[model samples]
Target: MSDTFDPDHLRAELLPLSTLQAPSEEAQAYQRFYGLNALGPNGATSSRIGRVEVGGYDIVTQLWVPDQPVGTLVLMHGFYDHVGLYRHVIDWALGLGLAVIACDLPGHG
Candidate 1:
């Protein structure tokens, strides 16, 4: 890959993540900048980050699950926030054996 934004390739890789998989190299770069992997809070049974088109708008989404999750939690961020900013929250929910799904606000992060 080059130093460019390759949406097609990313979609090809990300679209298959039903429950989530390892991050691609390009994704790792962005993840670092976004603190997606901060503090080693990666105890999820599976996790995924992807984009979805809803009402013709692109939104970044993340899902994290723990083993034997008792329930699910849909997290939301404030204005100008992204999913990466809530890693701790994700970790907390996962620690409580809850699956978490969150998305970035439009045109932010």
Candidate 2:
């Protein structure tokens, strides 16, 4: 929130990401029930990740363009959260042809 904080540089540095580890039995079962793939690494994917200028500030975002985007889905993370944490969600949205706009709000830890 302070002018001293450079969002662009921070985004370029340590973008948040969940470490891909062995899934629990429960998680695997849930994935099977929903016809979903394994989480994170083996899940839906997109590489168009970058920062976007919005409201005169650099809002870090990842663009997952679908074959035919039905519409846009803007995902705003809660306090102390970053957009990268929702990579799987964004991947799914891209697969469904929905453009995503995920933003890391100010003061995210």
**Each candidate's lDDT (Cα)?**
0.67, 0.50
Which candidate has the highest lDDT of all? Answer: 1
Off by over 4 Å in 2: 1-47, 54-56
lDDT tens digits, residue span 1-109, model 1: 3434454565456643354567777665655565554422344456677777778866667776776889998998898776767877877777788888887767665
TM-score of each: 0.71, 0.49
The TM-score obtained by model 2 is 0.49
Give one digit per residue, the lDDT tens place, for model 2 in 7-84: 434455433223223433443332244333232234443333334565676554444445556898888888777654
* Candidate 2, poorest ten consecutive residues by summed lDDT: 14-23
Q: Candidate 1's C-alpha lDDT?
A: 0.67
**Candidate 1 wrong stretches, greater than 4 Å:** 1-22, 38-44
